[model samples]
Target: MSNDVKPGRAAAIKSALESAFIALLASGVCLWFLISETQASDDGDPAKLTMLAIGLSAGLCAHFVYMAIAAKRAERNATLWVILMVVLMPFTSVVLGILLFNQVQEIEQQAREEGGAGSAA
Candidate 1:
């Protein structure tokens, strides 16, 4: 399948980066909440527990970003992987952004080749 990003969609890169950073921050905040709860002599507050759970889960998702990066690097399953990540956790947008950045060199090479070929004709 073609790997070309649709032309004129630069905003997606920015969006992904923003999403990733948010996810990371949220996860960190949640961890802090959990720690505070623990320090509080097992307060048993559902609200704190809920935030802790969510934060830990989101943090787990950060590791999954490698899949997104690979899929995009392979240029075969960006949409599918990206969608899965997003549906599973909103923070995965950062993964997408990281993938995009990681793939830039390859993308630039392909563009140059295509451009040269077109010019040669």
Candidate 2:
């Protein structure tokens, strides 16, 4: 692969990781709001809580879609990644992102070494 393509793939994976992290953060905030509202004596504003829930869902969905696209671009199993992201949204994303990033780096390094050897010969 061209050096340019390698960076583009890496950037896409990084962007996906960022998206997942944002979604995970939003999930935490949403959970905190839910717990606080339940524990408080006074009723919390339903509209605000509803809006927060909606935003959290949207963030998660965006993360899933972005990650799937990134995985596909990286020649990884997009469907499997999406399923894992959906099933374990809060915990699995960062691990998978790191694995994918490392895999891409390894691939790039191997390609570079091979190309160098081929040209030298």
Candidate 3:
């Protein structure tokens, strides 16, 4: 077999990135809904309130996903319930992504210190 290094990221990191991306999308959708609701209200539309609520919910869900990712990556000492609650919020997914990035940095530091530690047989 040829000695070719595999180009891949840790499974946990991939999951965290996925979660963060989804949350970002949700946040965008939520923002759009909020704007639409505001316009509807200006036009005296009865659906404005419902649209606003939808936007709020989307934002909340986004936050929770991020929090969940952080908790799974073992980078944060956040409580299960709190992480769940936060991850479900909008714009919070980005926060989780940032934290995960920080964790990766820490991992890199450890790897340097250990000098190729934990090599597979």
Candidate 4:
């Protein structure tokens, strides 16, 4: 019930937000490239395209790893989250990140309440 936030929870929330933002940015870049008139093999630069693809992959991978670690720390099923995120990356990464973030917040809040109660007794 206290407004004060723990450093660990704050860090976790920041990490989740950052990962989600990176995934969203990468997805937007890929979408823009797909809709643009640039052809990777033609007048367009294939090297630039390759770099963009690599960036997108890296962002997705980072998001997946973050989720997996967060799930494990929150006592959730890390394997299930990792599999789901991998199968639905670039499109569902942000959603999954938000879900995990909320779950972590809830878990932290419950722990705080329990600790406060124990201390009060």
Q: Pick the candidate with the highest TM-score.
A: 2
Clashing pairs in 4: none
Q: Between candidates 2 and 3, name the one with more favorable TM-score.
A: 2
Using all chains and alpha carbons, the TM-scores for the candidates as numbered come to: 0.45, 0.70, 0.52, 0.61
RMSD of 1: 6.6
Stretches of candidate 1 off by over 4 Å are: 1-7, 55-99, 104-121
Candidate 4 residue lDDT tens string, 1-121: 2345464764675575666566657766775774462654456677776766776677667667766766665556779877877787645656666775676577577778878999999
lDDT (10s digit) by residue, model 2, range 1-121: 2334365576677677667677767767876776777678477788877877787677677778877876876777899888987888756677777777786787667667878899999
**What value does the lDDT take at residue 72 in candidate 1?**
53
Clashes of 2: 0
Candidate 4, backbone clash total: 0
lDDT (0-100) at residue 29 of candidate 2?
Answer: 81
Q: Write down the worst ten-residue block by lDDT for model 2.
A: 1-10
Residue 76 local lDDT, model 4? 61
Model 4 gets an lDDT of 0.65
Q: lDDT of each model, Cα atoms only?
A: 0.61, 0.73, 0.57, 0.65
Span of ten consecutive residues with least summed lDDT in model 1: 6-15
Distance (Å) between predicted and true CA of 78, model 3?
A: 2.6
Which residue runs does candidate 2 get wrong by more than 4 Å?
A: 1-5, 107-121
